[model samples]
Target chain A: MYCVETDHLTYRFARNEPVVRNVHLQVPQGSIYGFLGQNGAGKTTTLRLILGLLKKQQGIITIFGKSFEEHRLQILREIGSLIESPSLYGHLTAVENLTIYQKIHQAPKNRIQEVLELVGLSGTGKKKAGQFSLGMKQRLGLAIALINKPSLLILDEPTNGLDPNGIIEMRELLKQLQREQGITILISSHLLAEIEKLVTHVGIINQGQLIFQGTLPELMSRREQSAGIVLNTSDSQRTMGVLEQLHLGGAVESSGVVLPFVQKEIVANIARELVRSDIAIYGIQQRTDDLETIFMNAIK
Target chain B: MHLLNIFQSEWLKRRRSLASWLVVIGGLFTPVIIFTMRMVYHQRLSLPQKFQLPDFWQVSWNQSWESMALFMLPMGIIMATGLMTQLEYKNNAWKQLHTTPQRMATIFCMKLLIILIMLVQVFVVFNAGLYLFGILPSLLLSSVSYPAADLPVAMIMQWNINFFLDCLPIVGLQYALGLHFKNFLVPFGAGFLLWIVSMSGLTWEYNYILPYSYTMLDYLVLAGRKIRIGTDIHVMSVMYFAVFIVGGYAVYIWKNEKG
Candidate 1:
C-alpha cells in the first residue's frame, strides 16, 4: 500500500493564483521517493499539504490511510518533517532542544542521547545551537525529526547550503535510516543527479504538474524505448549523408551521428552499415540511464 | 514530568544569557535603593525632632517588603515583559513551541509560571536585603528609645501581603502587552507608559485599574485609614488575577497566529 497518497491535491494562496494545480502523488511504503522540481515548483507546497501545515483548497491528502487535517496530530506523530530551513530556537543547546521535542512526543530520555549520537552530535550537548555551523544545524534538525522514531521522514532540500562532505553524510544517514528502521522518506531536490544516486523511486514535477512517477528502473525503461546509439566519426558530413541514404532521420552533431531506435538489433545493423560503407566509426555508444534524460523527456 | 522537562530545557536556554543575570541582579537593587533612601530620610527627620521627641524615627525590619513596591516589583515586571517579547521577536520561538504536542495553554502557563518563580526569587532576596539592613538598626535603637510597637509592624506585614496581591494585575497587563506586540519596543514602551500614567494621581479611580497603580495604593493604604475605607483588597485582587490572566491568555490565543 502507498504510505502517502495525494489525489488531485490543489492549493492556492490568498492571491488566488494556483500554486499547486491538481498534483497527484503515490509514495509506496518503504520507498525512498525523490520529489524533483525547480524552485517555486510546488514540491514543498505539496509536502506541506500532506503534513497539513497548509490547507488544501481542493483535494485529498491521505497519509498512512488517514486524512491529514482530520487526524493532524496523529498523522504528525507517524510522520516527521524537516521543512524549509531547520527553524529552531537559537538559545537552546543541542540537548536542550532535543529534550523539548522529546517532552512533546513523550519519548524516553535514552532515545534523546541515542538520536544525538546517531546524528554525530553527541558530547556537543552543551554547545548552544546558535553557535552551530550550518551543517551541524542541519544534522541537528535531522536529529529532532528522528527523535520521535517516525515511520515516515519528509525532508525538504535537506542538503541545501551544505558542503560536499555534508551532503554525502546526509545522504548516507538517510540511506542508513531507511535500511535500519524501514523508514519511508520523501526528499525533495532540484538536482536530479543527487536524487538519482539515492532514490529508488522518483516523482518529477514541473509547473505544479506531476510529470512522472515510478521506479528508477521504470524510468530507465522509458528512456530505453527512445534510446539512441551515438556513432562518432571524423567525416561527420559523409556519415550524415550515408545515414540519410539509409532513410534514417538521425541527429547529426559536429563529430557524431545520433541514431534513435528502441531495439538493440537496430544499433547492430546501423554499426554494420556504417562499417560496410567504409565509415570509420571511432565509437558507438548507447545512452546511459540518467534522471535528466527522463526529466527532459517527461517535461518536453 | 512534561512541564518539568519543558521548564528545565527552557531554563537552561536562558540560564547563560547576560540579560537574565542582569535581571536577577537588578532586581536586588530596587529594594536596596528604596530602603537606603528611607534610612536617610528617617535620619534627617530624627535630627529635627530630636529635642521634642527622642524616638521620632525608627527603622524596622518589617518595612523591607514595602521597599520592593517602590522599585523591585515594577522592574521585575518590565524585565519579564521584555524577555517574553524578545523571545517572540528574536526568533521563531512561538512557532517552535507551538508545533510541539504540548498544547498552547500548557506552553503559555509554563512561561508564566517560570517568570513568576523568577520574580518570587527577586522578592525574597530583596526582602532579605532589607531585613539585614533594618533588623540590626531596629534592635540597636530599641534600647536608646522606648520599645518598638509590635502592632504597627504586624499591620505593615499584613498590608505588604495585600500590596503584593494588588500588583498581580500590573504583571498581568505587562504580560498581555508583551504578547500583543511582537516588537520589543512596544512592550517596553508600554511598561514605561504604564509607569508614567500610574504615577500621575490625577484620576485615582480609573488609574488604579493599571497594574503599576497598586504601588501608590499600597503607599496610601499604609499611610492611613482613608485609603482602606470601603476598599476590600482581597476581592479586588481576586478579580484582577482571574480576569487579567484569563483575559490575557484568551487574547494571546485569539491574536496569536500559528506558523
Candidate 2:
C-alpha cells in the first residue's frame, strides 16, 4: 500500500481561488518522496492537508491503507510533521520543549535526549529556544517530529533557512533516517537541486496543480528526451521562416534557435538548410539533460 | 490515558509562564494593600474619645473582597488567560500541537483545565494572605481600640469559596477571548474595558446578567454594616457559573473543529 495517497484533492483559502486544485498524489512505502514546487505553489497547503492540520475541503486522503477522515488520529499517530517553520516554545529550553511532546506522545524520558543528539542539538543545555539560531531551531523542530518515532515524516521546506553546511547536514540526516529506520518521508522543497540527491521519487507542483509525478528515473528519461540543439543564426526571424518551410520546428531563444535533437542527421540537415537559405550561422551546440532543466520545463 | 497525558503536558508548558507569577502577585495584592491602608489610617488620625474603632476584622474582609472583585480578579484572570494562550501562538505552536494524535477537544479542555487550576491556586493564596497579613497583624496591635473577636475562620472560608464561584464566569469569558484572538492586546484590552463597565453594572437594574457583576452582587457591604449574602444572589451566581462554563467550552470546541 502507498504510504500516502490523495485523490482529487482540492483546497482554496478564498472564494473562486483554489490554492491546491484537483490533484492526485501517490507516495510509495519506504521511499523518500521529494515534493517540488516554487514558493506559493501550494506545497505547504498540501502537506498540511495530508497531516490533517487543515481540514480537507474536497477529496479522499488515504494513509497506511485507511481513509484519513475515518482514521485521522490513528494515521496521525504514525505520522510526524513540521510545516513551514519550527513550532517551538521560545521560553523553554530544547530539552524542555521536547519533553512536552514526549509526555503528550507518552514516549520515554530518554527519547528526548536521544532525539536531541540525533538532531545535533545535544549541547543546547538550558538555553531558551528563543535564544537559538535559525539552524538550531530547525533541528529542534526536526527532533520534535522524530521524538514520536513515526513511520512517515512530512517536512515542508525543512532546510529552508539553513546555511550550506547546515543544509548538507540536514540532507544527510534525512537520508540516514530513511536508511536506518526504513521511514517513508514526504519532504517538500522549492529547489529541485537541493532535494534531487535524496529523493527516490519526485512530484512537481505548479500553480495549485500537479505538473509531474513519477520515479526519479522516469523524470530523468523526460530530461533525456528534452535534449536539443541550440543554433545561433544572424537572422533568427528569417531562420524560423525557412525552418517552417522545410517542415522543421524550433523556438527562438536568446542563445539561438533551439530544435529537438532527434538525430545527428537532423543537425546537419538544419545546418545545410540554413546555409542554403543564406541565413548566416554563428554557432551550434548541444544542450545536456539534467533534473534542473527538466524541472524548469515541467513547471513552465 | 491520553487525557491524563494531555493534562500533564499542559501543566509542564505553563510551569515557567509569567501568568503564574502574575497570579501570585495578584492574590497577595488585595490583602497587602488593605493592611497597609489600615496601618496608615491608624497612624494619621486620632479618634474622638467616645468613638470606637470599627470592627477591624469585618473591615479587612470587606476591603479585601471588594478590591479582589473590582480589580484584582478581573485583571488577573485576563492577564493569566492571555499569557497562557500567548505561549501557543508566540511560535505557532498551536499548529504543531494540532498535528499530533491527540484530539483538539482534548487539547482545548486540558488547557482550560490548567487555567482553572491556576485560578484556584490564586484563590487559595489570596485567602491565605488575607488571614496571615490582614487579620493576624490587627490582633497583634494590643493598643488598638478595635473589638477582639477570634479570627472568624468559618466566615473567611465561606467568603473565599463564594468569591471563587462568583469569578467562574469571568474565567470562562477570558479563556474564550484569549483562544479566539491570537494577539494579546485584543483580549487584554477587552478585559480591561469590560471590568470598567462591570463597575457600573453593580448598581444597574439587571446586574445579574453581567458576569463581571456577579462578584460584587454576591457579597455586599451596606452603610458600614457587616457584609451580607442574600439567597437570590447565591442562586444567580450558580446560574452564571453554569452558563459561562458550558458556553465557553462550546465555543472552544466549535472553533477547534471548524479550523
Candidate 3:
C-alpha cells in the first residue's frame, strides 16, 4: 500500500499562480522516496501539506490510508517531520530538547537515552544545542523527529548546509532507518548527487510541477534512444541549414552552435559544411548522464 | 500523563532559567533589605510606638508578604510574562514543545503552572528570610517594642488569602499580554507604566479596570483595614481576573491557530 498519496493537490499563494499545481505523489511503504527540486520549487510546501502544517486548498492527502484533515492527530503521532530549517530550542541541551519532546509525547524516559545513542549524540547530551556543530544540530533535529519511533519520516532538505561528510552520514542514517527499522522516509533535497545514492524512487519537480516520477532504471529507459552529441560548428546558422538539408533535425541547442541529433554521420557532414562556410570549428563531444545536466535538460 | 509530563518539563526548565531565579531573588530582596534596615533603626522607635511600628519592615510571614507585594510582586509578574512569551517567539521553545504529541491545553497549563510556581517561590523565600532575620532574632534575643509574631497563622492566612485573590488577575493578565505580544518590553512596559500611574493616582480612578491594580493590595493594608468580603475591591478583582482568564484562553487559541 502507498504510505502517502496525493491526488490532484493544488495549492496557490496567489489567485492565478499555484505553487503546487495538481501534483500527484505516491510514496511506497518502507521505501525512501527522494523529492528533487530546485529552490522555491515547492518541495518544502508539498511536505508541509502532507504534514497538515499548511492547509490544503484543493486535494486529497492520504497517509497510512487515512485522510490528513480527518485524522490529523493520529497521523501526526505516527508520522514524524523536520520542516524547513532546524527549529529547536537553542538554549536547551540536546538532551533537554529531547526531554521536552519526550514530555509532550509522554514517551518512556528510556526512549530519550536510546534515541540520543541512535543519533550518536549519547555523550553530548548535556551540551547546549546552540553549541552543537551545524551537522550535530541537524542530527539532533532528526533525532527529535525519530524519538517516537514513527512509521514515516518527512525531512525537508535534510542535508541542507551540511558538509560532504555530514551529508554522507545523514544519507547512511536514512538508509539504515529504511533498511532496519522498516520506516518509510520522504526526503526533499536539491542535492541530487547525495539523494541518488539513498533513494529507491525519485520525483523531480520544477516550478511547482512534477516533471518526472519513476525509478532510476525506469528513467534511464525513458531516455531518448539516440545518444546525445554536442557539435561545435563555425557557422551555427549554416550548420542548422545543412542539418535541414540533410533532413537530420532533432533539436539544436546553445545558440545553434551545438546541435544534438540521432545520426552520427550527420555530424561529419555538418562539420564539413560549417568549415566550407569559412566558420572556425572549436570542439565537439557526447553528453554523458549527469543529474545536473539531466535536470537542466528536463527543466529547459 | 501528558499533562504531568508537560508540567515536569516546564517546571524543570523554569528552575534552570537564570532569569527566573533572578526574578525570584529580586522579589525577596526588598523584604530582606527592609528587615536589615529595620534592625538598624529599632532603637529610634519609642517602646509604645515601636509596638505599632507598622509590620512594614518586620520580617514575619504576614508582614514580609505585605512589603514584598509593594514593588517586587509586580516585578515577579513582569519576569513571568517576559520568560513565558519569549519562549514562544524568541527561541521557539514553545513551538518545539508543541510539535510533540502533547495537547495544546497541556502545554498552555504547564506554562501557567510555571508562573504560579515562580510566584509561590517569591513569597516563600520572602517569608523564610523574615523568619531568619526579623522573627527569629527578636524571639531568641529580646523584644524591642512589638512582640514578634513569628509564624502567626491567622495573620499569615488572612494576608495570603488576600494576596492570592489579588494576584490571580495580574498573573492571568500578564500571561495573556505576554502570549499576545511576543515582545518582552511591550507587556512589561505597560505593566511598569500602569504601576507608576496607579501610584501617582491619575489612573487610580480607573485602577479596577487595569489588570495590574490588584497588586496594590498592600496599599489597603497600609491604610490599616481588616480583610472583608463583597467590597468594591473584591468585585473589581473578580472582574479583572475573569477577563484575564477569558483573554488568556483566547490568546492561546489564536496563537495555536496561526504559525
| Residue lDDT tens for model 2, B159-223 | 77777777777777778878888889998998888777877766666666666776766555422
C-alpha RMSD over true interface residues, model 3: 2.8
Which stretches of candidate 1 lie above 4 Å from their native place?
A52-58, A205-209, A219-300, B1-13, B17-23, B34-72, B88-95, B133-164, B170-182, B198-205, B209-212, B223-257
Ranking by DockQ: 2, 3, 1
Indicate the residue-level lDDT of B238 in model 3: 71
Model 3 - which docking category? acceptable
Query: Local distance difference test, per candidate?
Result: 0.71, 0.81, 0.71
Error of 2 at B115 (Å): 0.5
- Candidate 1, residues B148-233, lDDT tens digits: the string is 43324464456656766766776676777777777777877877787777767524655455556676566555544365323654
lDDT of 3 by residue, A1-300 (tens): 999999999888657689898889999998899998888888988887787655678999999999977877788788777876676677788888888777766778899988888878899946887788877888888988988889999998888778898888888888998999999999998867778889998898887888888885665654443347666665566666766776766356763444454566766776787677676777767765565566666766
Which structure among the candidates has the greatest TM-score? Answer: 2
Model 3 chain B is weakest, by summed lDDT over 10 consecutive residues, at B222-231
The 10-residue segment of model 1 chain B with minimum total lDDT is B50-59
* Candidate DockQ scores, in order: 0.25, 0.50, 0.40
Q: Best by lDDT, which number?
A: 2
Error of 3 at B107 (Å): 2.4
**If both were scored by lDDT, which would come out higher, candidate 1 or candidate 2?**
2
Best by DockQ: 2
